[model samples]
Target: MDAPSGIISAIVTGLVIGVLGRLVVPGRQAIGCLMTILVGLIGAAGGLAIANAIDAAWLLTLLLQIGVAAVLVLITASATGRNQ
Candidate 1:
């Protein structure tokens, strides 16, 4: 993908990853849509950075991404005082 396409792909992937992360966390989180997207984007970016450092396989990389996203969601929820 080119630059714009790559960015769009990242946003889309981030949205999905963020939603999946929220789902993984078993509780009602008070985060909004935009916040969710932002969290997901950050999580995905963080996860990819770590994955690059580790040079893991695709499956493990994916799991790590999702796991990282979940952690971010949890943190966001806690920070927002919505995780209870």
Candidate 2:
């Protein structure tokens, strides 16, 4: 897929991943739905960049985005936990 296609698909995929991430890494993030989507979007971009750097296949970027989003969610959850 081309750049635009990747981005479009990422947007859709990221939404699901974002919610899954939040549920997996539970905490009082208090993030609204829009904010969660934003975080997922950013995380997907970051993941894609890293994938490009490492010459990862296009299909892998999809997986990368989810993995990164999950990690970010987990980290954020842990951070909030520590703060409390």
Candidate 3:
């Protein structure tokens, strides 16, 4: 199914947010571009869940998109010492 313009834009934004978020935490991701995009999408969804639980404001989704994902990457990297 084809996505609407808004959905497409959101996907692009999420992809960009994911790349930046990963970069925030030091590591060699060694993943493909597609994987990076996938990670970003997953991170955004996870962030949204946490944000919703914490009652983050509506306007901050994009920033929270990056922040939450970055925090997630940081936590995971610190814990595993490697991405699995």
Report the candidate with higher lDDT, 2 versus 3: 2
Q: lDDT tens string, model 3, 1-84? A: 457987887678668877888878676655556656666777788778867878888657666777777875666555655664
TM-score of each: 0.88, 0.61, 0.63
Cα lDDT tens digits for candidate 1, 15-36: 9989988999998898989988
Give the winner by TM-score: 1
Q: Which ten residues in a row have the lowest lDDT in candidate 1?
A: 56-65
Candidate 2 is scored at a TM of: 0.61
- Point out the higher-scoring one by lDDT: 1 or 2: 1
Candidate 3, residue 54: how far the Cα is off, in Å: 1.1
Rate residue 37 of model 1 by lDDT.
Answer: 87
Per-candidate clashes come to 0, 0, 0
Q: What is the lDDT of residue 69 in candidate 3?
A: 70
Task: List runs of model 1 lying over 4 Å from the truth.
Answer: none
Which residue pairs in model 2 clash with each other? none
